[model samples]
Target: MLCGGTSAARPATDETQQIADKVKPQIEEKEGKTFDVFNAVEFKTQVVAGTNYFIKVHVGNDEYVHLRVFQSLPHENKPLSLHSYQSSKTKHDQLTFF
Candidate 1:
């Protein structure tokens, strides 16, 4: 018989931070803006044999950005992947903002 239990949550590891650091510059360049603040909202590991990280960033007044970073398993030796775009519009629409 096998039993499974949830693991305790852990703070962001150095590797995760490094992934964020590596992706931030690209996001800033593509968005043509500087981020005043950035927060990681989600992290998943061993999902689909890789890791995923989601980040929310504030670029300026009423401007918000979301980024997703995917890192393949080390055994695969694949390069990191990233996707980023403005998320505030959707948030506003959902909130019924005019």
Candidate 2:
């Protein structure tokens, strides 16, 4: 297995001390709308020099992905090692969030 490296450059940057308002829901939007998601392998970490406030959710697979999703959210009670993954057929079809 090949390990990946990291640097201080991420496309959706929030490096500086700043906060923005969330206008709408991420998964749902009106007509003629689209949202960008990072469907990549080396996407596990988006490290800043010295910070623990950063948050990333890798909801889907990284290697040989049937699906991939990466997003930055404010810190939640959810653990960082914790992820949402289910490979079986029945659970995947029934699972839905709102």
Clashes of each: 0, 0
Mind giving the per-residue lDDT tens digits that candidate 1 earns over 31-56? Answer: 67667655443233334457555544
Residue lDDT tens for model 2, 1-98: 12323333233344221211131122223213332432222222333332222223222343121111223344644322212322222212322210
Which prediction has the highest TM-score against the true structure?
1
Model 1 scores worst on lDDT over the 10 consecutive residues at 89-98
- CA shift at 76, candidate 2, in angstroms? 14
